[model samples]
Target chain A: MMEELFIALWVIMSILAIAMAIHAVLSRDLIKATILMAGVSLIASFLFVLLRAPDVAMAEASIGSALTAIILVLAIRNTKRFEEGGGEK
Target chain B: MMERYDIHRSIPAILLALLVAATIFYAFVEVGFGEAKVDEEGSVSNRFISNSTQETGSSNFVTAVVVNYRGFDTLGEVTVLFLASAGMGAIVSALPAGDKRKRPIPPSLILTAGTRLVLPLIILFGSYVFVHGHLSPGGGFQGGVIIASGLLLYLVIFPEWKAPHKALALSESLAGLSFAGIGIIGLAVGGIFLDNVISGLGEAGMLVSAGLIPLIYIAIGIKVGAEMTGLVARMKGGDA
Candidate 1:
């Protein structure tokens, strides 16, 4: 039963990751894309936990999702916010 | 340049991507995702698994392998991180000071108050993670990033706030020096760099048992925390 729940979560998270990746690519708003990419990293960290690598999971959650997201957001803040041509606010 | 989206031009690209994805999928299935790929009795991983506790006195084998068996590689990683952050600071500083970003609306009172309350807790938790690295799953890198995240929260709320650059650089230099110094000490006393000079300090499961492992991790934690905080501060256009 426990294993069943684990597999269910694994499948769900994998699907969510794929969906988020697609959305992140399709989104023209750079900030939105960055956030969706962070969501993907968050799901990847969850998948790491499911794979029983807690250390990797922690690193992924903190560095991949949080720090990378913040860095990308700061870059966006310094530059344009949208693809092609958009003025900074 | 192709002025508009051309389906004909993209069809080949799409097919190539699908073909590459299929090949990767086939390889991944063959390897059996999430399964241990090295389980042979005489394999290096097995050797580490068998001897890690007795040799290093670290309850966490991953920690033992990373901090003891492959400590030099870890040092190289630390150096790489330091160089990357240094380069970032140099590049950002060389750029012209742009107009300051002005947020139209002030940060919410809840966020400000909540950050003030949670910052200390985040810092405490980060230190705890690094301190207990040998016994637990997290180590210096994760802990350092967590600490930086706390500072990031404050930075987000207060865009004009500046980190004390001199203090951060001093702490970072001290931490880096101590890490290398410990390795040198191990070489002097134990005939090898980063040797477990005091592996028999205490009981195996206790905090002090892993000897130089904890100390090394502490240095790494401090160095990483300072470097990451400095990186983020400089990246935010602060005078580093």
Candidate 2:
């Protein structure tokens, strides 16, 4: 029963991860996309922990999610936000 | 509002997602479910589990792996961190002075006050974590990050809080030098790099029993903390 529950949770997590990845890719706003990407990375880190890879989870949470989010946010500030007409020309 | 997408960017993004999903699915299907039965008497896992207490004198298998079996790899990892920090510092230093004037303005009062109150205690706790890492789950990397976060808090809250550049440089250099000094001493005395040298392994579970492990960790913690703090300060355009 517990194994079944674990499998169910894993499936749910994977679905959420895929959904977040798609959202990150499709989002029009850079900030929103960045946030979605961060969320995906964080969820992936949690999955690593669930998989019993604590060291990899720590790296993912710290370097992958946090540092990448910060760097992307800073890059966003330095670059143009979005095309004025909402289309990439 | 729906907008026309750039096929160039969108295609790559979609492909990347697909690649990630495919890789994860493959791993889960191919690897994650395997389990092996162990013999009651003398399996490889059992032997290691039974004798690990005597071999490394560490109850935590991960700690034993990190500090004993793969000690050289840990040293190399520390070197990589040091190099990364140095590179970041050098790059940030090379930015034109006039460009510094255009950096982001300081965060507001509420943020600053809260950070100011919390940063010192966080740094203190990080030191404690590093000091006790061998005995607990925490380690140099965790503690280093904690210390770095404290410095980052300061940088965010007080953009103008000039980090004494000389002091940061001194601390970084000293830490690196001390690490090398310890290794050199080991080589001189024991004819092996990073050997225990002056300290003995003592009894198994005591605070000081790990010989050179604690000292190496302490050096790594200091070096990592200083480098991270320096990097954060430089990246934020604070005086370093």
Which candidate wins on lDDT?
1
Q: Which stretches of candidate 1 lie over 4 Å from their true place?
A: A85-89, B1-27, B36-39
TM-score of chain B of each: 0.89, 0.79
Whole-model lDDT per candidate: 0.88, 0.71
Q: Give all TM-scores, in the order shown.
A: 0.91, 0.80
Worst 10 residues of 2 chain B by lDDT: B30-39
Q: What shift in Å separates residue B238 of candidate 2 from its native position after superposition?
A: 4.9
In model 2, which regions exceed 4 Å deviation? A82-89, B1-8, B20-30, B33-50, B97-108, B197-202, B238-240
Q: How close to the true structure is residue B223 of candidate 1, measured as C-alpha lDDT?
A: 90
Return the clash pairs for model 1, or none. none
Model 1 per-residue lDDT tens digits across residues A1-89: 99899899899999999888766665567898899999999999989988889999999999988899999998888888866633322
Reference-based TM-score, model 2: 0.80
Compose the digit string of candidate 1's lDDT tens values, residues B1-240.
322333443456567757987999988887776777567768887888888999999999999988999999999999999999999999999998766755547788998899899999999999999999999999998899899998988888887788988999999999999999999999999999998899988978998888999999999999999999999999988565
